[model samples]
Target: MADIESEQAAAAAGSGALVLFSGGQDSSTCLAWALERFGTVETLGFDYGQRHRVELECRDALRQGLTDLNAGWAARLGPDHTVNLAALGEISNTALTRDVAIAMSEGGLPNTFVPGRNLIFLTFAATLAYRRGLKHIVAGMCETDYSGYPDCRDDTIKALQVALNLGMDRRFVLHTPLMWIDKAETWALTARLGGEPLVALIREQSHSCYLGDRSHHHEWGFGCGTCPACQLRAEGYRRFVAAAV
Candidate 1:
């Protein structure tokens, strides 16, 4: 099984990949993962009017930081693309898109759950990849240690991969490297990928706070330190640090 996976990874390394980068820790880690493997790597972000829209602002700096970490990454990194997905926000009544408090919805999910967000994102990513002639669409969607967003499940991604290929008549591989890994593992992966420098870059530049609060800096990063995103990141960083010690 390991040999087969290695062969698959080697085959994928020869192709170009489009990373769905949101300028958050997981997406940033996934971006580094793509840059290290794919022959060419491009980034695509969505401006969905998220309350944490500040994350979008972190994209360029993170990209530059990644490029600075390695000459090869700089050479392999391609153009960045941002699509205006403001319509998603208009339709979403969740806390992430509105001024509402973060709470559990009556549907047994968090109010931050943007319905069909990832599905729409993947569909649009597939469209962009098709136009860009890219063969791989990389995302940071993960099930482990997430906020119960159904769209982040591995099965959802796998099903969407089939739908996209069938609908587009193209062989587009959707890569979610963080699917099975927890947030602590994600931070550890970044350290392994580019060492402490990459880890520091992610901690400082990436924005994952639901409230868009960059005013307060935590050891993990800049956030409100209470939102689900921030809490998860902080706890993960604590674990990462403790494990390192």
Candidate 2:
């Protein structure tokens, strides 16, 4: 088993990686993480008709910003692809896909939880990776300090990895660097990866608010500050800053 795992890792390292970048802090950090490790790195985004579709707009700038931060990153960064998963929005009636209120559902999960979102996302990403001859799929899905999205759990990702490999007959490795880290650690990670310039780029450009608001700018970033995404990011930034002080 160890040897097989080593073989898989070796194969993945050679074939480059595809990062599921959402123009959010976590995904941006994950992109940098992939660039640091992989020889070739590409990005993929989904147009799921999300409320914060504005995030899609930030993707290009974020990619270019990362390139400008490091010459090596610019050389390794490859083409980006965006898929139109608008049907997801048409089928899901939730806060993320619709204009509904952001609250906990009676079932306990947040309304922002889009059913089978990560599952579908990974499946699509694996399909693209296969087409692009990329054996590694990197995502920013996190269980720690998240909004209780079941799909973001490590178990879900691992299970999906197996399913994707079997379904595609390809050994595609799913990399989730943020699976076990909180938002504070996530901020620190960007700092470690690209220093203050990358941190400032993420703070100024990345969009995490569910309401799609970019008018308000806080020390952490731009958001309404009341939404779960903004609150988590803001509190995490506070903790990260306090720890450094």
User: How many backbone clashes does every candidate have?
Assistant: 0, 0
Best by lDDT: 1
Q: What does candidate 1's lDDT look like per residue over 70-173, in tens digits? A: 99999999999999999999999999999989999888999999999999999999999999999999999999989999999999999999999999999999
Candidate 2 — worst ten consecutive residues by lDDT sum?
A: 6-15
Model 1 scores a C-alpha lDDT of 0.95
> How does model 1 score by TM-score?
0.96
Instruction: Give each model's whole-structure lDDT.
Output: 0.95, 0.93
Clashes of 2: 0
Residue ranges of candidate 1 with Cα displaced over 4 Å: 1-10
**Residue 228's lDDT in candidate 1:** 94
lDDT of 2 at 27: 95
Instruction: Output the worst ten-in-a-row residue range by lDDT, candidate 1.
Output: 6-15
Q: Tell me how far the alpha carbon of residue 135 in candidate 1 is from the true structure, in angstroms, after superposition.
A: 0.7
